[model samples]
Target: MSVESGGGTQAVERAMSLLVCFTDEHSELRISELCARTGLVQSTVSRMVSSLDRQGFLEQDERTGLYRLGPMAVTLGSIALNSNPLYRASRQSAQNLSQTTGLGVNLAELRDDRLFYLANFEGAKSPKSFTMAGRTAPLHATGMGKAILAELGDDYVRDYFTKGLVDAYTPHTIVDAATMERALQEIRNRGYATEVEELAFGRACIAAPIRGRSGRVVAALSMSGPLSELGLQGRQEELALTVIETADEISVALGFTVTRAPARRTTTAPKETAR
Candidate 1:
């Protein structure tokens, strides 16, 4: 490669490396931190950070001398989000579910073995769940994450487990690999995932996978509420059925067709009592 071309490539890589240094845990970073993490010289890191600030990929706090991801990053993310059919379809479904169920609803995608909450809704009269867009939850501890894991099938889930991605978040969390494997199988058979204070001490959730036009799970939709009300043994099955039904509607909107064989049945009610 020509010297100029190679230099340009290295500069872009350095800039991206600096940008990635700002994450949810580290929303802002100093030059020294960036240099340490990226393993780049302080001068190179500073220059790249400055260039990225000018380009709006990052912004610097003049007083603190720290850099954070900027508006352009949100703009780019908006562009990508607006183009996703699942987001568009699931947003409305999530809103409707929250309104109808009077509970908090979440729309999320599994990314890098974690559930990245894309949108959240709280019903007008419902107590709010502690969640919001851009928040993340562990795959092995949340309903939506488990729903996506189940949709990903055993091979993928096992491979991901082999990477040691599963973590216990609460006393109710299922961390044993074999037990979780059986739980995922049950989720698939039942067409939804359920959580009983798995992620939080007194909260429960039911989640179902949303499929895409390709008939593969692209995301998950979930409803969450208090353990006392939503986690009653009798209510879990009912709520799971409701969530799965709604998820099926979203999947159809996204182009997944139910493949059940057609059957005809006649409903015979005892002739209205001739009273």
Candidate 2:
């Protein structure tokens, strides 16, 4: 590559890295902190930050002199979420699942190598689960992640597994990419995914993929709870089936037709037995 092209790529990378530095804890930062966190010169950080601010990607408080994510970011995110047909149809299904199972239900979409929560429903029970709407989870450790991966073909799954798995909440999390790939393959065959103490200890989740009109998987519907409340053996299959049914309902609502193959006949009765 030419030096000019490489320099431009590096600049874009650095700017994106800087933007990612803002998180739940440090939602706002000053120029000095931005330079320190990004390891870039103050002049370069200031110029890039100013350009981002002008483009409505970053917001700077006039009095506090702190920068946070801007309105355009929220606007773009809103547009992306609203544009998903599966998410639009699954809102009621998620609520119904939450009510029926008395657990937390969520719809998630796979994006940028992560599962992004699109819609969520909390049961009427007070003081429910702590997960928030719009939260993101790694694709190797959560049921929703597996469900989305199961929808993609084997080649896509292999490429995703090569990216490596980062442990998020628990030690049971599948850190090895190969194992995760195998697990996702099984999930694809089974038509659902289950997470038992993988994401959070004592928490179990079941998810199924929501397909689009063209039979492409677009999102996942999941139900989660504490393991003790959800039995490990008997209830797991039942819960998985429930999630699958709910996902199919959502898919149908979104205009995806479910066509079942005809069952094969095993054997024919003997002619002598007809007497």
Candidate 3:
């Protein structure tokens, strides 16, 4: 009986792993592609795919044999999003920020060393038919990613680039470790970060880290737009301040209380020590 139970558990895990193989970029995939992604034998993958299809976790395209997520997956995703406290806390604030600024507002959390967008509100000035709610961006290439990285320790940040930065999405991307380190330090000092045409040409963003009640960085908030707009010569500081304030609002909503540093008492330097 114990052996049978263990086998059943293994089967369930494999089936879940198969489901996880589908993503925004690879939403529709063939069984062979699934095998390559999951490294499972064709027979095992085929059986599990069939089971998933029947259970409404996956649906196959009858004409192309490509499989895509089924309704059950969508239902579960909705439930998960609705249940997330961070998402709930930031949704309205993100909406308001986007509406007021006419710039995209994004909320994302760090996952697997990448920024995974949980919600996005497109500005009225730049409406899009789709959203980035379920997409991931590299940690080294986005404002939110940099803002979150600024909250991490120096040792961790150093180790993060030990393998060196990967994927330069645009010519302006910071590819060298020294440059990235300096940028993160600036973010730490300013309480916000900026991305100037790093992820895509003509695009820029300002972002700030969000902390939870535990005083740990839990996510980041950002305002994104065309470089011509967000990168305006005189308005960068204003936009950055707005982004930081909004992010702090979200952090407070998440129960984080700002801990102000004690003011330093300045004393006039001792009379010149001319012995």
lDDT of 1 by residue, 60-85 (tens): 88899788999999899888778877
Q: What would the per-residue lDDT of candidate 3 be over residues 166-197, giving only the tens digit for each residue?
A: 57888878777677888776677667777877
Query: Which residue window of length 10 is worst by lDDT in model 1?
Result: 266-275
Give candidate 3 misplaced runs (Cα > 4 Å). Answer: 39-43, 259-275
Candidate 1: which stretches are off by over 4 Å?
Answer: 124-136, 228-234, 259-275
Which regions in candidate 2 have their CA more than 4 angstroms from the true location?
1-19, 38-67, 70-76, 124-134, 166-169, 175-182, 232-234, 261-275
lDDT sort, best first? 3, 1, 2
Give each model's whole-structure lDDT: 0.77, 0.76, 0.82
Select the stronger candidate by lDDT from 2 and 3.
Answer: 3
Best by TM-score: 3
True-structure RMSD, every candidate = 7.3, 8.5, 7.1
Steric clash count of candidate 2: 0
**TM-score for each candidate, following the candidate numbering:** 0.82, 0.71, 0.86
How many steric clashes between backbone atoms does each model show? Answer: 0, 0, 0
Q: Taking the tens digit of each residue's C-alpha lDDT, what string does model 2 give over 111-191?
A: 898998887777653235454557788887888888787667778767776666466567777776577667766675567
